[model samples]
Target chain A: MKKDHIRELVVLSGKGGTGKTSISASFAVLAGKAVLTDCDVDAADLHLLLRPEVEQRHAFFSGNEAVIRQQDCTGCGTCLDICRFKAINTTGASYQVDPVACEGCGVCVRFCPASAIDFPKRNCGEWMVSTTRCGPMVHAHLGIAAENSGKLVSTVREQAWCIAVDKRIPLIISDGPPGIGCPVIASMSGVSLALVVTEPTVSGLHDLQRVLALARHFSVPAAVCVNKWDINPGQTERIEAAARSAGAEVTGRIRYDRSVTQAQHQQKAVVELTTAAADDIRLVWKQTAAML
Target chain B: MVAKTHGRAARIAIASGKGGTGKTTVSLNLAAMFGAPVQLADCDVEEPNLNLFLRCEQLTSTPVTMLIPEVDANRCTGCGACGELCQFRGIVSLGTRALVFPELCHGCGGCIRVCPSGAISENPHQIGTISVGQSRTIRLVEGRLEVGVSSVSPVIRAVHQQLRDDMPAILDAPPGTSCPVTATLLGADYVLLVTDPTPFGLHDLKLAVATARTLNLPCGVVINRAGEDQVGLYQYCQAEALPVLLSLPDDRQIAEITSRGDLVAHVLPEYGLMFTELADKLQQEVLKVAGGRA
Candidate 1:
C-alpha cells in the first residue's frame, strides 16, 4: 500500500489470437497476489478464463449524441445539408439522425435554425470491478458501435490502479488489446513492463515490430514471449533476433499445444490443466516474474 | 456453376470481432476463387497479412494524409475559440500557446472555421500508406499504418478509394468492433463475418453482428476452425436466423500450410471448390437481399 510500490505488467499481442489472453490468465494463476485488469475493452476474453464475479458495475459515458425534436417547426433540411458524415436521414417528411454514424460533432446542433436539437451524453459502455479465483479483476465492454475505446481503457486502468493501491497489492497485470492503436497506447502508458506475446509467422513478426516501437515510444520497457514457437522454429528464431536487435529481451517461448484450446474449452487457464504447454507457460511466467 | 451478374459490382467485407479468427484467410481464399476481375483490399492497416498469402507485385504506394490544424503564434490575440470548438480535444490552449495533438484530430475542420484570430491553418500529416498491387489476376490493395500513428480509419478510407468500381471487391476489415472496423464496413453491400468456435469468439461475434445490424447491412457467418466442442457458435447463429455460409474444420494439414504462408485453397484443391461454392452463395445472398430492398 506504499506509494509507488505497485509494479504493473501488461501482456499484449500486436496481432490478435496470438495467445495474449491465454497467457495472461496463466500468469494470473502463477502470480496469485497480482491485481488483474483486462484492458482489451473491445474484445475482452480474460473474464472467460478468470470467471470473475461482478462486485461493482459503472456505466461509461464519454461522447455526445444529438436528438431531434420533431414538432419544433418547418423541416428546413439545414442539419442534413451541413452534416459531413451523412449521418442525417429523411423519411421525406422529417429529418432524423443515425446514432451509429453520427460523430457527435455538434455541427448539426449549432446549425439547426429551429433550435430543436438536444445533445445528450452517450452511454458508450460499462466497466466492472469483480473478484476472481486469482484476485480482484477490472474489466469492461465497449458498447456495440460506440466510440472512445481509448478513454474506456484508461478508466479501467485507473480503477485497477486504485484497487492495487487500496489493497496494497504489489503488482497489476493487464491484458492489453491488439493493434498499436489508442487503446494499446492507453494500456502502455506508465506501465512497469510490457510482455508482448507473439507467434512465429510473417504477420506476427511484422506486428511485433510495431508494438515494440509503440512500447519504446512510450518509454515502457518491453519483453517478448513467442507463443507457438514450435509451429515454425525458423520464424521463431527470426523473431527473437529481431526483438533482440530492437533491445527487447526474449523472456521465454511456449510450444504449440492443442491442450491450450482444450483448457479454454474447460474455462481454465493452461497452467491449471495437465498440458505440455502448461509447463512452457510456467517457464515463461518465471522469466516474466524475474523482470518484474 | 451458375453464371451471375449484378447491376453494379457489389462489395463484400470480411470481418471478425476478434483478431486471429481467420478474416484474412477467408478473404484471400474467396478472392482466389473469383480468379479474375476481382479486387481485394486489406483494410487491416495495422497488420495486413493478405500480402503474405498472395504474391502481390507492387504497383503504386500512396500516402494517406489528414489536415491537422497548426496554430501560428504571431496571429495576434490569445483567444481560445479553436480550443473550445474541438470536440475531440485536438487543440488546447495552455496559458500563452496552443498545442495541437494531430493524432487526436478527426479532421472535422470545425476548429479552423471557428478560430477568431485566424491563427489556425491546416497542415497535411501523413498517417499511413495505401499500396495497390497485382497478385495473379486479382487486384490487391492494402493499407499500412505508419508506426507511432494512433488513428487508422483515414488509411482505411484511402484504401477503399483505390477500389476498382467495375469489379467486385472484397474488403478485409480490421479485428475488433471499433472505428477502424466501422470505416471498412461503411459502404459494403454485404458482410461475411468469420469467427472461431469459442466463448471469446461468440462474445465478440455478437458485437460484430450488432454493428452490422446498426448499419442495416445483411450478413452471414463463416465458422473457421469448426470443431466438436464449440457448438455454442452454431446454436447462436441458428437462433438468430443467421445463415452459416461455410465452415472450415480444424485440420492440422491446413494449419501447417497456413503457417508456412500458403493458402489452403492453393495447396489443397478440394478447398478451392468449397471457396467457389462460398462465392456463389455470397452472390446469391447479395442478389436476394438486393431484390428484397428493391
Candidate 2:
C-alpha cells in the first residue's frame, strides 16, 4: 500500500463524543494496513478498540518544572512574589512548588535569591508505538494534571509518520482530541485531509463552525461527516449546508445505531458489524478515502 | 480541595476525563435546578458553548490579556540575560537584540525579573474574551479562547474571576485529565464527574477521579446513559466509596432536546425531579464534606 505521497488523514471533532474515535477506528480497519495514532493523549481511548500491543515506548519530556529545595532555606518569599501561576505554596516556614500548578515557566527559578529552585525536565506523558489488529499504531498516556499536551501530540504524530514509512503504509489515520485548541491544531497541521466528525446539534454546529475556521486557518483540506444524523434531520441538513458553504466536503452521514455500541463492547470497529451503522460508516470511509 | 470558600458558596466543577460525556448538560441542568441564583461558568474556553444554550442577548465581553515580556530596545544592551533566563525561547538575545515572540511567552515575568539591564518589561497580549450574561437563575460567564492561543489556563482563570463568592457556582470543565481541566477544577469545593456507563467511560473516569484526587478535591459520579451497569462503573464507585449520585437513562428524547440546546429540566417535567434530587444529593455531599473538615 506504499505510495509516492503518504496520505495522513486525521479525524477530528471540535466537540467531544460525536463518534470521533469510533469512526477513526473504522477508518483504520477499512484502510487495512494504515498506521493508526491517537492524538488525544490526555484521554486516549482508541486503544480500547484497537488494543495495540506495545512495541516501543518513549518518555515524553516537555518544558521544565521548578522544584524548591527545602534545605536551601533562606525562607525568602522572592519566588512567591514573582510567581504568576499561583504554583508556589508559602505554607509553613518555607515555600514549596506545587508540581500540579507549576507551568514550568522558569520565572520562579531565575528570581529566587537563594537560587533554591531546581529546574528539572518535566515528564509530562509517554508515547508508545504498538501493533494493533488494524496495523501498526502509536498512542500515549498523559500524566494526570500534566501540561504540554500539544508537544506530546506532535511527538505522537511524528512517531506515527515514521511507522507509516517503515511499514510502507500509504495512509495514517489519527484520532484527534476534541477541541480547537493547541492539541487540535498540532494534530491537523499538515495533514493531507481531515474528516471533521460532528453530531447534528446546536453546540455541535457551533463547535463545527469554529473547527472549520481552524482548518481554513491552517489551509487543511477538511471533510464533514454527520454522526447520528437521524436524531436531528433538520440540524443535519443545516450542518451539511454550512459545510458546503464553508468550502468543506460533506462526505456522508451516519445514523445512530446500537450496533456501534455492541461493536465497542466487543472491542471491535463498527464496520466489522453487519448493521446499518456499519454500512453508513463504510460509505463515509469510501468518500473520505476518495478525498485523500 | 484548597477550599476556595468557607461555607460560603461551594464551587462545584462538573468535569469528565473523557469528552462528550454530558459535562455541559449536567452542569447546566444542575444550575437550573439549584432553585436559587447560581453562577454557571463555561471554563471549556476552547469550545465554549453554555452561551449557545443560554442564548443571552445582553452579554458584556472583555478581552483577557496576559503579560508577556517586552524588551525596551533603546535601553541599549543585548545583555543576553533575558535570553538566558527564558527557557521557552520567548525572548532570545541574538547578541545584538532580544527577539520577542509573545506567543511562546508563558507570562511568567522571568525575563523581566532577570534582566540586568532593566530593559525587559511587560506587555499585555490578548488571549481570549470573557462574556458575562444572565439566564433565568444562572449568571453565565463564558470564556472564549481566541484561536491560535495554545495555553487555556490564563483564559480559564479569567472566567473563574467572575465566580461570585455569594452564589453557588458550577464550572463546566473541558474534557481530559490535563492542565486545562486542573486549571478549571482547582479551588473548587467538590467536583461532579459526569461519565457514561461503558468501558471508555469507566477507564477515563479513573483518570478523572485521579485528577480530582491530585487536587485533593472530593468528587462524586453521575453515570450518563446508565444501563445494567455491565462495565462496573457502579462497582468501581462502590469499591472506592465514591458515591454514585445519579444514574441517567439512555433516553433518546433527552438527547433530542439536549442536542437542540434546550434544557431538559425545563422542557421535560419528568426530568425536573431528577435534577432536583441530583442537586440535593450534591448539596448534601458538599455539606457532609464541609462538616467533616470542621
Candidate 3:
C-alpha cells in the first residue's frame, strides 16, 4: 500500500507581528482536513487564535539541571571555579547552582570533587494534542527561561507529522516562530514549502531576505506574501522583486486592515469575519493552494 | 575596557516575549531621552533594526567568532567520548570517522577537553559582526548575525562584551523567551518589557514577565500602542503587582514616523519628556530592587 506524501506548509515571518499567526489561523480555516502545529513554542500564540481544546497533554523534558547535594558538604569551590556560566551561587554553608543561569554544560557535575552535584533532566514544558475549529492542532509552551526550544519545536512538529499520518491528512500547516534562530531552523527542515509572511517596512524586507536565504540554504521551496502591502507600495514591489530574484514565488498580497485585530479580539480567523482583508487572505490561500 | 572606565553604569534590557511589540522602539526612544551617557546595544542580531532608526557617525564593525571543533582524522580512534559528552549533538562518531555539525555547536569547548585522542581542535566560525557607532548623543552597538547561522546567543554575547560599564546601557533584545532573549537579559539591572494591548501581546508579556521573575531581575511593563479598549493587559499588570512605567497611545503619526526610520521623540517633543521620565523611573526601580547595585 502506497501512502500519499503529506504537504507540510510552514507559515513563517522573520519579523514578529507581521501577522503570521493571523494568516495561519485563516489558512487553517481554508485548508480543510489539515493537521496544524504552532512551532513558536517560546511564545505560542496560534493556540490563542485557534482556541484548541486540549485532549492529550504531555510533559516535555529536556536539558539537565545541576543540584548540589548539601549533605556531601565538601565546602570546596572547585565546582564554582570550573563553572563557565557563573551558575554557582554561594549560600550560607554550601554552593548552589542557579538553574536559570546554568547552561547545562555538565562541566560542574563532572568536575565536582565530592560528587555533590546531581544532574537531573529538567521538565522544560508541556505540549498538547488538541482539536480546534480548523482541525487537530499540536502546540506547546516552553518553560520560562528554559533552553532547548529547538528540541521542543521539533517535538511539536514530529507529533504533527504523526497526527497527519495517522489521520491520513493531506496537509500540515505550521505557524513558525519569528527569527532565523534554532526554533525557526527546526520548523523549516523537511517542510514541503515555506510561506513567508512579511510586511512593507524596511525591516520586513531585510528579514524576509534573510529568511528566504535560510529556506534556500535548506533547499526548501519558499513563497512570499506581503501582509500589509499597501503600507508602502514601493517597498512591497521591491520586496516582490527581491523575492523573485531570490527564487521565491510571490504568492499574493494581503491588505492591512484594522478588522484583523478585531477578528483576533473575537477569537475568529479573518476569513470568518466581514472585512476586506478576509477577501485578500482568501486570494492568498487560493494561490498558496495552487502552488502546493 | 571603555565600559570599565565609565564606572558601574546600569545595564537596562528592553525585551518582549512577542515579536513586533515595540521593544526596539522603546529602547531607541529611551536611549535618545536619557541625559547621561548611554550605549544602546541592539542585541537582536537576527534582524538588527535599531541601526535603521539611529544615524551613526563613526561606525566600526568586528567579526564575532565561535569555536567549532574540527576532527583530526590522523589521530583515528573512533571513541565516541566527544559525541557522548556533547549535549547539543554537535559531533557524531561514525565508525572510524567523526562528523561535526558546526551550526549545532554551542562553542562550549567541551569536546576538545573531553576527547581522549586529542583529535578535536577548535576552528573559528564567524557567526556575526558587532558594530559600534555614535548616533547623536547616544553611542550605538548593534550585532548583525550572518545569514544561515542558526545560533544567536554567541553573537549576542559578543555584542554585550562591547558594552561600556561606565554608562547606562540599553539592550534591545530579540523577541521570544528563549536562549537569545536569555542571553540579552543576562546581567541587566532592570528589564522594561514592551508590549501592546492585544491578546497576543498580553499572552507573550506574561511569559516575558515570568522569565524576568525566574532570573530575579526587577522588571516593569511599558504598554505600547495603548488603546481605549484593551484593559486586560493593565489588569494583569495590576494583579501581578508589576508597575506600569509608561504607556504610548496607538497614534498613527508615531507609526508613520517609525515606519520612516525615525524616532518618536524626534517627531514629537512631548514624547521626549515621557521617555525621560521613564528613564528616571527605571533608575529608581533599579535602586529599589538591587539596592545601589547600579
Best model per DockQ:
2
Task: Look at candidate 1 and tell me the lDDT of residue A44.
Answer: 85
- Model 1 misplaced regions, further than 4 Å: B1-6, B65-76, B93-101, B116-127, B146-151
What's the residue-level lDDT of B291 in candidate 2?
89
Q: Report the C-alpha lDDT of model 3 over B1-294, residue by residue, as the tens digit.
A: 011223477788999988888887899899999987799999978778887778786789999988889999999499888888788788888878899988777776777877888999998998899999997779999999887676677789889889887778998988888777888888577889998888888888888998888777778999987886553888899999899999998776665567667788978988988999999999898778656433
- Of 2 and 3, the candidate ahead on lDDT is 2
| DockQ of every predicted complex | 0.58, 0.76, 0.55
User: Compared with the true structure, what per-residue lDDT tens digits does model 3 show for residues A34-134?
Assistant: 89999888888998789999999999999888899888959889887767667788877678888777778776777677888898998899999999988
Worst window of 10 by summed lDDT in candidate 2 chain A:
A1-10
* Rank by TM-score (best first): 2, 1, 3
For model 2, name the residue pairs that clash: B1-B216
- Candidate 1 lDDT by residue in tens digits, A210-231: 8999888889999999998887
- Per residue, candidate 2 scores C-alpha lDDT tens digits across B13-57 of 999987889988899888899888999999988778888889888
Across A10-119, the per-residue lDDT of candidate 2 in tens digits comes to: 99997778899899999989898888999988889999999999989989898889999999958878888888888888778878888988888888777788888899
Pairs that clash in candidate 1: none
Candidate 2 docks with a DockQ of 0.76
